[model samples]
Target: GPKVLQIPSHQIIDMGQMVTLNCDPVSNHLYFYWYKQILGQQMEFLVNFYNGKVMEKSKLFKDQFSVERPDGSYFTLKIQPTALEDSAVYFCASSVAGLSNERLFFGHGTKLSVL
Candidate 1:
């Protein structure tokens, strides 16, 4: 079975700092996506990337957030100048295709806290 793993189950950071969350997606998958869920809110799509460029990004993907593969290694999401509102459970997901893709497999999530 395919699986995605996220490191640092919990992270606490001060405001205005940079944070990079790591994700190890299923080996055979190509498309990668990031989603964020604030406390008691529905999960929202942030961005999707494939073939070295962003395929789609939602309004939630603010200017401070970026995603990259960087040599087929772990998928990473970096947030620079973090804000209080950035605190949420970040989930990493991957799929085989974009349009016809089925349900995404998500990691447990990395809980981030910004103060």
Candidate 2:
């Protein structure tokens, strides 16, 4: 598995506030992804990014959420006017290939607390 590092292990924000989670994925990986997991629940896919574009996103990825990796910098997931339901542990992952055949490497995850 590749190594993925996510900054700010824990984030606490008020409801309707905005937040951005940063991930430093494997340098050579071609695909990046975000997943959300609530306590005692399974991890749910949010979105995947490749070649500076968003390739796919699940319904869980609300309109307020955006992702980007400017100039090959940190892969980021930003949420504006976040809701209380948005609170969860966000996992960042990367792989050499697409979601189907590649082995994904995941970060520990950034826990978000929206009050």
Candidate 3:
């Protein structure tokens, strides 16, 4: 099954720094999503984008976090001034449409280590 692929596999950064994670999804995927998980914790949705706009974002998406696919290519998630609490595995996902029940193909995830 085709799935998303995240770049840099892992990232280590200092607090107050900025990091951008890139996600390469399948060619036909239309909806893009970002999720965050801290080690053993359950994954939480951060945001979803479609039609060149943000369809929804969770409280976890702070002011420092943003997402976009400028060239309709790889979807990207950027976080600036990252906090120590921001250390987590960020997963990128995609699906064909907005159907809630549709299964999303997820990337391996970018493990962010904030120090």
**Local accuracy by lDDT, each model:** 0.93, 0.95, 0.94
What lDDT is reached at residue 53 by model 1?
84
Instruction: Give me the displacement of residue 94 in model 2, in angstroms.
Output: 0.2
**Sliding window of 10 residues with minimal summed lDDT for model 2:** 95-104
Cα lDDT, model 2, residue 115: 97
Which pairs in model 3 have colliding backbones?
Answer: none
lDDT of 1 at 93: 96
Which stretches of candidate 1 lie above 4 Å from their native place?
Answer: none
Off by over 4 Å in 3: none
Cα lDDT for residue 2, candidate 3 = 91
Tell me how many clashing residue pairs each candidate has: 0, 0, 0
**Model 2, TM vs. native:** 0.96
Q: Top lDDT: which candidate number? A: 2
